[model samples]
Target: MSGDDSLRAVFARHRVRLLLAVVLLLLTMLAGVGLLGLSGGFLTAAALAGALGAGTTFNFFSPSAGIRALTFVRIVSRYFEKLVGHDATLRIARDLRVWFFRRALPLAPARLGGTRTGELLARLMSDIGEVDGLLVRAVGPLLALAGIALASIAVAAAIHWPAAVALLLLLLLIGIGVPLLAVHSGDAGEAERARHRTRLRTLAYEGLEGAADLAALDARDAWRARVDGAARQLAGDDHRRRGRLIAGNVLHSACAGLGLLAMLWLALSAFQDGRVTAPLAAALVFLTVALLEVAAGCGLAWQALQSARISAGRLQAIVEQPPSVSDPAHPRPVPASPATLSFEQVVFAWPGESRRVLDGIDLQIRPGERIAIGGDSGCGKTTLSALLLRLWDPQAGAVRWGGVDLREVAQDDWHRHVAWLPQGAPVFAGSIADNLRLGQPQADEARLWAVLEQVRLGDWARRQGGLSAWVGENGATMSAGQARRLAMARALLRDAPLMVLDEPTEGLDVDTAEALLVDMAAALGPRSLLMITHGHLPDGVVHRQYRLQRGRLLEVGGEAQG
Candidate 1:
């Protein structure tokens, strides 16, 4: 679907609310026009009646009552219009975020390889926010203009056809022509504005997020320069867009002035021909000016629409992006018991890469067995784990769980049978228990402490206020070793049959790394284990060890580097 269609789909959930807002806006505008027209006619008729003194009578009560009624309607409807319109817009904004997350989650680490977190953040917050403004800025104003135009033309016609024709032409020019011209004029910068805005947000977030590292590395100035450049470009885009918006507003104002002048000339000619009275002519002039004011807002609405369109396109790019891997249409369930993993002559290459990361590899890990594989940097040691986790299927061979092809099984079902501790696992900004509970949400206090104790974090947790203690963003509050251990604890909390530890002890000292590896091995009572690392393996931790060479695994007779 196109971006426009996608955006429509996003708002479809709140369509009823949006329709109600539009109705309120139309009623509000009509009331304003009526109030102005009645007040003008009443004052003029009263003045003329007073000039005739006791010889003439004016019906003050009825017109005065009508003015009061329109005044009340205008005020009340305008208030409700704002309330309903903003409520509906906020609802759509909330849902848009949820919708984007649902669509983007399945594509992670694979199809999302090219996307940065900051860029995604900007899309989620800023772009989606601009879309939310569509209801108030674009939709409401257009509906109001339409209602005001019809009412104003009818009133003008009652006075004189020439006056009515002039009002109609003016409304059409301001409502349609001027706004369309502004929209098209702003179109060139709308997309660029969105891009630069996202880029600015991305750079700002990156700079703030990595401020410490940049300062320590003496790279703060360089990063700031880039951020400044992004800011300048974004400012330029905004300037161009503002220029068009201002130009459109000026054009509409000029047209409204000219429209009033034309309406007055027509009214005067009608009065001279005895078709319109002096009081009625004055009323028509006031009504014409009010109508012009209502229609003039169309230019601003058009500019808002242009901005919203660009935001919709940015949001659509992620919501419509294809996942790197899709689950089978008809999937089988994984084994109920402990699953035995096997790789049969698996060969693989990353998407768009020519060199094979893994080639003709065969291996197995049965229930209650421990195995470790070592490899140099960039030798696809982690690639093997990704295939095992079904993050990406092998290009050549099938990875089986309990003799069944992994692809045939539902991804979620397969995930339930295994626990994986990826290298450099992130620690979310939350309570210690909150982060750990992600692995197993139902884990009780005793269970959490037990897992923490296993990873040597139990004492630290107690000292810091136990499970309720906060872990800063990405575990910034903890030492590197503590963060690694906390991540391991999270992985260990999962009661799965198979566990894959990819450099689980990274960031710890050699002695601590070895001890952590030994602790990890001892913690696996019945579950099968596959530890992938470039470091030395702990003695007796695994039943077998292998070395990953160029696209192949070579069996080693003894222990490798820790």
Candidate 2:
């Protein structure tokens, strides 16, 4: 869908809430008008009695009672209006966030690869905040203000047509003209605000990531200065935007005051000329003042709308990015027992890179074959593994599993059938059991322990509370070797038909790495293995090896000669 359409759809989702808020606001406004009418009626009766030279002692009591009752009713309606409007806005904000994030997930590690972590964080938090203000604070209040303004003008027209015209002009000035002026003056302020937030977040993230380096270099003062500079820029932007906001408020208030004076003056003249009575004039004046509050809300709401527009634009950019890999409209069902994997003349490159990472590559692994891929660091070994898992689509070829194109299979289905131990495998902050469950959530304690033993981590697991030990944040408490072993155990527990191991023993000691591989190979027994590494192969472990260079695959030793 187009970006405009997507944004419109987002707004449409809140249609029900928007309608409810409008309806409630209208009812509240009408109640306000009814109160105005009641006060006017009591005043009119008192004035008529005085004009006729009759006693008017009871007039004060009647108008006071009506004013008190109306005041109570207005308060209750206003409270409910706020309650429902805010609740609705929060719901819309939640839905938009969920929708944006869900669309973002599949495109990530590819489309999102180039986006900075801090920038993404800012979009997720600050940009989303703008959307909330747009939907709830801006729309609801504007709608309410419009409703009240129209109602007030209509009522005033019945009392005095000229006065009604004056009030309507004031409404236009406060509700529309002043806001437009503010928007014109603050043309790029919202975008600037979003940009500043993104920059600040990026700097903060960099500072945190390089805190150790800065300390080592004794550059703390420089870093602090940088942070302080960003803060000052942010403050400056805020100051300018708020200055415009204050100007808009001042203009709106001035307009409202002029409108109230015109209404009151007209009413007094009508009363003296016998065109209206005293009580009605008093009520009209009070209603005009109350309506001013709604006009003030209108000005604020306009500013919020402008801010939200910028926020939604940022969020929309993320949501509308075409997925690098998307599911087919009609996906083929994956086989229950696939036998082989193949890559046919596959050419791939990282986005924007001149050279193909994997050029015209062709390979096939028969069912249950143990294949090792040996290559230099930049020869695209990990990239090939990622393709096999369909993290990214090859630019000029296809990867097929069990004779079915990988693209044809559902992503979750493909992931389910293949287990992976990535290069620099991630160790999440959690217990061993918690980590293991990621591979197979239903795996029992016995199964978990068995996998740990298979990877030579069973001893470590035993010493560290077995499955229940805390790994600390990002496995910070664990040694590099221990973290690698734990990751291996987690991958092994998957028990899938295919396993792709990417430099799984890169950081291990010789003996530990050797022992772990021996045990892993035995446990993996006939499952198809595609292992990528530069390390020497253990004896009798790998049945075949392929060397990758310049995007070309060449078989080594016995396989090619045969």
Candidate 3:
């Protein structure tokens, strides 16, 4: 999507709250100007009286009451404006995060494989920080400044046309012209900031991933140097941007000073010619300077606009990425009963690779059959299973379920009916029950225990506080074997008709692996199983075995072994 389109979408989502905030902000600005005008009138009235008469006849109560009331309104309006605007900005930030995450979900294990954990975290968090200024700093201030400028010009014109014209010209020069100049002048600084961000992200991710290695090798100094270098680059970029911002501010101040001088000259000329009263002239001059605050506010808001533009471009890139796998327009329902799986001359390849991973592979398995696929690493065993799960569509041929192409079924439906235990299953930082609940959100304690029993983890779980036991970050507090077994329990709890096991026992002890396999076969009786294994199969378990070699699947003994 284009940058403007993306920003419009964000605005559409936030427009209602933004409009309310802007309206309140305009009211606040109006009240502030009224307060300033009344105070100036009060001062001029006090100045006009002779010493004894000023002390006795100055109508202090009237102007004091008006000033007090207007000040109260301004304060209240300002408070609500900030409250509503900041709340709305936070809401937009949350929605953008959800939108980005949902869009990136289906592209995982392939599209997301190359991204580091730290970098992705930064994008989801820090990138959103940059975009927050769009609503918080840019929108409300610009709207308020526009209102103040127009109102000030109208008031000035009613008093003297020359003062009004000068004020408008100065506002245009500072608020519009200088900002455009700053944007052009700061382009190099912005580019440098982008580069600095990339370097920081890369270094942060590398340091996180290599923390253990760096500690072991006493290389903390080297990593610190790299981090410091990235930080210095970011600092330098910020310094340049600030320099440009200061230049813009200086230009704005100069224009405001010139406008004030013109307003003073016009007021004095009108006073000398007896075309205006002294109090009127004084009010116009004071109001003219007060309105300069509006111009400076707009200048600061413009910088926020520039930052938002940069962040919007980055966010748009992710949102506009097309999904590699999307549901069909007219999705077919998955079969109610368990169904046979068929791969007919299926061919597949990695995203950017020229060579296909699976070439002309044809296979069929009856319902409730247990099929074991054995192969060396990178020989298409996992690729075939991923295709069955519809992670990616085959470049040639089709994978069918119950005589219907898998692609015809809704993606959600297909996933719902099949449970996949991927290699090194992720263990979130939560209790054991929390981890298991991902597979079966509604599973009760009894049901959880049953699945744990099936996975041979029931006794162990009962000893570890049942389902409430904490599993530390990435299951770090648990051994590799325990984490794997916990993942197995989760898959068992899913209770889907088909189970795809990918290296389920890779890191388990021989006894533990055999026990898991035995229990899995018993629990999954009469359920279709497509298991990927690199070890010797248990005796009297798998009904058939297929070996993948050089991207081709071959029967073990020239017969269906079932």
| TM-score, per-candidate, Cα-based | 0.95, 0.88, 0.91
Better of 2 and 3 by TM-score: 3
Report the Cα lDDT for residue 59, model 3: 73
Clashes of each: 4, 2, 0
Model 1 worst lDDT run, 10 consecutive residues: 1-10
lDDT at 85, model 2:
79
Tens-place lDDT per residue, model 1, 448-539, is 99999888889999999989999898897898888888888888899888999998877778988888888888777898999998888768
Task: Evaluate residue 481 in candidate 1 and report its C-alpha lDDT on the 0 to 100 scale.
Answer: 80
Residue by residue across 427-497, what tens digits does model 3's lDDT show?
Answer: 99999999999999999999988888877778888888888998898897787777888898888788888
Query: Model 3, clash count?
Result: 0
- Candidate 2 on 1-562: residue-level lDDT in tens? 4454465676687788778877777777767766766776676776678787755454578667777987887888778877877887788788778777877877777789778888888888888888876756787768777787888888878877877888788778878898888778564887887788778888898898788899999998998898888888888888888888888888887777777888888888988898865766776787777677656667568778888888888987886788778788888988776488999989998877989998888889988889999989989998999899888899887999878898898898888889899878888888999999998999999999988888778888889887999899768878887788788888888889999998988878888778767877888867899999988888867788998888888788633311
Candidate lDDT values, in order: 0.85, 0.81, 0.81
Residue 189 lDDT (model 2): 85
Residue 245's C-alpha lDDT in candidate 1?
75
From the highest TM-score down, the ranking of the candidates is 1, 3, 2
Candidate 1: lDDT of 181? 80
Which parts of model 1 are misplaced by more than 4 Å?
A: 1-7, 558-562
